[model samples]
Target: MQIAKVRGTVVSTHKEASLRGAKLLLLQYIDEEGRLLPKYEVAADQVGAGVEEWVLVTRGSAARQVEGNQTRPLDALVVAIIDTVSIDNRVLYSKKDQDRK
Candidate 1:
């Protein structure tokens, strides 16, 4: 699992049958300090995350499993809303910061 910032939402009229009714969100991989990391990709939303939300994402087979399906074509999934993130006892990102920004 990794942390990412939700960039936006994806709308698809056509997709795998298993993916129907699933929310797709664009996620930007980020560092511990909450800076954007190198890669960005779309993910299935299992936890109802919204745009610009900092989310915890699971990857690979684990991601698909979290959605309660094993055969779905998914590489990532937003599993949680991060309330706070700390590094070296320093707060990096938090819901409070989001509210302030």
Candidate 2:
């Protein structure tokens, strides 16, 4: 899995039957320190993640299985909304930052 930031949503008027209720999103990969990394791609949203939100994504066959469909035609999928990310006791991200109230 990799950390990514949701850039935007993808709308599809027509798609395969297996992907009927799936929502696609554009994601930009990020590093452990929350820094935006090079390369960006689109993925199916398994969890409800919004633009600018940090999300956990899986790729390849693992991604397809995450959505509960082994035969899915997806290469990537957002599996979770990250609440916090820590490395060696250093907090890289906090849910508080996501709370824009």
Candidate 3:
């Protein structure tokens, strides 16, 4: 899994039948310092994360391991909405802090 920020939504008018009703989101990968990386991903949202939210994303076969998603054509999936990210007790990002800004 990697840390990523939700950039926006990806609407698909036509998709595989197995992917029906899935929420697709555009995500920009972020580094350990919270800097955005050039790489981006379109992941199926399993956590209902909104734009700008920091999320935990799992790619490849790990994404298909989730219940009810095993047959979906999902290469990536949003697994968690992060509340805080810390390293050595130094908080790098906090949802509460972001909300206050």
Candidate 4:
């Protein structure tokens, strides 16, 4: 799994039947220090993560392991909504802090 931030939502008028009800979100890869990378991807939301929230992303075949995504044509999936991220015993990000801004 990798860390990323939800940047936006994706809406498609036409999609595969298996992905009909899935929510697709745009995400930007973030490093351990919480800096955004240039890479971006669209992922199927499995945990209902919202925009600006930090999320855990699973890619490739691993993304297909999520319960409802098994048969869907998904290469990435948001598996968790992160509340806080800590590294080297330091807190890099916290949802509460983001909410205050």
Candidate 5:
């Protein structure tokens, strides 16, 4: 699993049958310090994460392990919505803080 930030939503008029009802989100990789990386991925949303929320991402074959994603053609999946991220006893990012802004 990797840490990523949900950037946006993806909408497709035509797609595979297995992915018909799945929600897709655009994510940007972020380091533990909360800095965004150049890398980005479109992932199926398994946890209903919203835009700008920090999320846990599962990639490759592991993404397929998420419930309801087993037979879908998904390479990445958003598995969790993070409320806070802490490193070395310091809070790096907090949803509560962001909500105040």
Candidate 6:
């Protein structure tokens, strides 16, 4: 799994039948220090994360392993909406702090 920022939503009117009702988000990968990377991807949203929120994402085959996503065609999936991220007792990102920005 990796941390990423929800940049925006992806709307596809001609996608596969199984992905019709699924919510897809555009994510920009973030490093451990909470800096954004140049890489970007679209992920299935099971956690209802909003734009600008930090989320935990799983990619590749593991993305399809999440419950209802087993039969869907997904290369990535948002597994959790991040509330706080810390390392070495130092807070790197906090939902409350972000909201105040």
- TM-scores, one per candidate: 0.87, 0.86, 0.95, 0.90, 0.91, 0.92
Q: Is candidate 3 or candidate 4 better by TM-score?
A: 3
Query: In lDDT terms, how accurate is model 4?
Result: 0.90
Q: List model 6 lDDT by residue over 17-89, tens digit each.
A: 9897899999999998778999999999988999999999998998898778889989999999999998999
Q: Against the hidden true structure, what lDDT does model 2 obtain?
A: 0.85
Encode model 1's per-residue lDDT on 1-101: one tens digit a residue: 89999998789887788888778898999888788887988888888887778899988877778536567888888889999998888887888878888
lDDT of 5: 0.90
Candidate 4 lDDT, tens digit per residue, 1-101?
A: 89999999889988888889898999999998789999999999988888889999999998899677889999999889998988888888999999899
Q: Tens digits of per-residue lDDT for model 3 on 40-96?
A: 999999988998999999999988988889999789999999999999999999999
Q: When superposed on Cα atoms, how far off is each prediction in RMSD?
A: 1.6, 1.8, 0.9, 1.3, 1.2, 1.1
lDDT of 1 at 93: 80
Clash pairs of candidate 5?
none
Query: Each prediction's Cα lDDT score?
Result: 0.85, 0.85, 0.93, 0.90, 0.90, 0.92
Q: Residue 45's C-alpha lDDT in candidate 5?
A: 90
Model 5: per-residue Cα lDDT at residue 21: 92
Poorly placed runs, candidate 3 (over 4 Å): none
List the candidate numbers ranked by TM-score, top first: 3, 6, 5, 4, 1, 2
Candidate 4's C-alpha runs over 4 A off are none
> Can you write out model 5's per-residue Cα lDDT over 1-101, one digit (the tens) per residue?
99999999889988888889988899999988879999999999988899889999998998899677788888998889998888898888999999899
| Candidate 1 ranges with C-alpha deviation above 4 Å | none
Q: lDDT: which candidate is best?
A: 3
